[model samples]
Target: MTGWLPVAPCTPDGCARHTGAVRAPLPAALLLLSGCALVLLGVACIPLVRLLGAGPRRRLTRCWARAVPQAFGVRVIVRPHLPDGAPDGVELVVANHISWLDIPLVASVLPGRMVAKREIRCWPLLGPLAARGGTLFIDRDRLRALPAAVRDIATTLRSGSRVVVFPEGSTWCGRGGGVFRPAVFQAAIDAGATVRPVRITYRTDPHGSGLAAGAVAFVGADPLAASLWRVVRAAGLTAHVDVLAPIPADGEDGRRALARRARAAVLGPGDLLQARQTAVASDRANRPAESVHH
Candidate 1:
């Protein structure tokens, strides 16, 4: 079941030679099935929203995400060490980027509006769900447009919904957290929202048996279908979700300074209290459940 199923590999420019037709029909079918299931679930959620309201609906959304991981033959292992305090008005959460799949992956774990690249807004079925879920899309090439978008994000946070952003700006292969983009971090500072740092890692096991840290990683230009096939061909995957410390919405730190600290906290070593005094402790005033994790 395990062997180096090699293609000619990619050139330095990241283009694969495609010398051999890498058959991915099995993985493709699995992905297509998952997408269909998600679409049905989205439609089913319409009525549920009427019955349960936004609170329960969002909760259900997260629940659906959690269930899909295993149903899709994925596993999630979360180790959260969040900083203490409540964000003053809104919250801006920053996290590492890994794959396109991270969308549903994080969506299942956190109930919030996602900040995605603008192209995602045009995606087939996923686009509609993201838009309905209040996702904010940014066109990276358009710097002029970012200011207004940031303001909009600030407003959304002030209205009391968490906004999720991947500060890395781009996805990478492996467990590595790529270079952090500093622009969007300003929303957290501008809105005085707590900036929570999150790191996500995926461990793949070809044999479908292993611990969290022991699994293989699927990274870098590995097509989704191919990656899934590689994983299915392997054992199983144990995904590690680490919620690092949050930085305060209030501090003497400038935007770049704050971004640096946050990037370090999520990417580098551990520091628990830096996030506590600024955000988490203050948040206890908003929701008692803020302190509790599922």
Candidate 2:
């Protein structure tokens, strides 16, 4: 990452811990193939999927999303803790970034428009799928283009569309995650939408061990192929998505404040404490270097 782009501290060698049992090479290969086949199948059904009504399309998309991860031998569990009676409007779903798989995990429950980098619109099969799914792309190369992009997102929200964004910007290795970028929250504020913070956590011991499955994170320079293989072979891998209660964007707070509000909601108490501890440890480790430089 360069310039104003966010960079995660997670690196492949340092953070991708391959925890849990291993799958045989043949079975893992088969699982990867099955996942690819599902992708192709989804691509083939694009037209039919587009023709369906919004509600039905979302339902079908949710099922297909769930199936994709299952094909990759990963189980996804959704804890839907929506408030009893939250007013319905445009919803801005913000989630922490973990891996490419986070996309499908989020789509499974909240099938909505995803915000992605502009380059993703040109990829192979996945590119077309995202375009068909009504993705909002951001041109990261041009800071000047952000206002226009924000306006476009606000317009989409005003149309009663749900916009999903990984506010962390870059993928983290599921430890002490990065802070949420505040720019996107402006869209929610402008559109008077409710900001919903969804937390995505990876666990290697799916027997409810709750271990961090950072092994599957596509952080730093890890190639996409390597991440795919790791995910396929990682036995007992499970993804937990906790959909926290929504925070109304109607408050007169600025985007930064809203970002903090949403991020706090996503991290919850446990993660917030972990993050603080991680920061403290990191500071202590760097203290020697700081003294040398001084």
Candidate 3:
């Protein structure tokens, strides 16, 4: 039962790792205006995109998604874990939830149907656009609605379309992430779709650095405007979308086990060790004082 959506303990004050260097106020304002304009253009045209064929619409979506980040001065790098490159098949793309940028970051590389919370349907500009873009809405607060949602995802996957889901169900700071909720994995198993684990990490510099960019994180009650402004002002913001190996849809593996395997893949290649340390430390710091003593 998914009556209770998984929530991250991360808060902007406690976990957001902001960049030390920032763009000048003038340049940042320019980037912010450009980013907002691009987003508005994309959202306003969602309905009109239906005039084009499915293939063309998908390409446009990917292009727009990629352009938005660039307008905001955020560099994106997509890495393929396998030698063959990103797989072409019906897949359930599951990723570690981080910033709001995670959605477009994934779409730029692996365009597909997205599974999102139903509440998004009411968000101002982007909400209606998401609905028109063929997003699958899941009622995470309604336990009974989950079964039907899973069935719908399975049906879509069966129709040979890829589906992207943030199985963590909530946004976490890039320094850490919540466990991947197993409910969505059921849809992949039901549809016999390969599970593609993706790891999205944000850094202050494009070149690999130890500093995690919390400036991009959208967690807890942080206002969207504030997060967006921080992103546009940040200096040298970079996002890495690492496409981990694909996990087979083994009917024998229950959703829980399948979710574990997927999470493992996303955290593999030495990431899990660092992630475990960060997650544990973050969790401990965020824990209630009473619980910390206990």
Winning model by lDDT: 2
Off by over 4 Å in 2: 1-3, 81-89, 276-294
* 47-105 per-residue lDDT for model 1 (tens digits): 55647766666666766766665555566666662222212225677765555556666
Task: Give the Cα lDDT of each candidate.
Answer: 0.55, 0.77, 0.75
Candidate 2 yields a Cα-based lDDT of 0.77
Better of 1 and 3 by TM-score: 3
TM for candidate 1 is 0.70
In TM-score terms, candidate 3 sits at 0.88
Q: Could you give me the TM-score of model 2 versus the true structure? A: 0.89
Best by TM-score: 2
Residue-by-residue lDDT tens digits, candidate 2, 71-155: 9999888887333223334899999887888889888877778889876788666788888777888777666676787888899
What lDDT would candidate 3 get against the real structure?
0.75
Model 1 clash tally, residue pairs:
20
Looking at candidate 3, the ten consecutive residues that score lowest on lDDT are 285-294
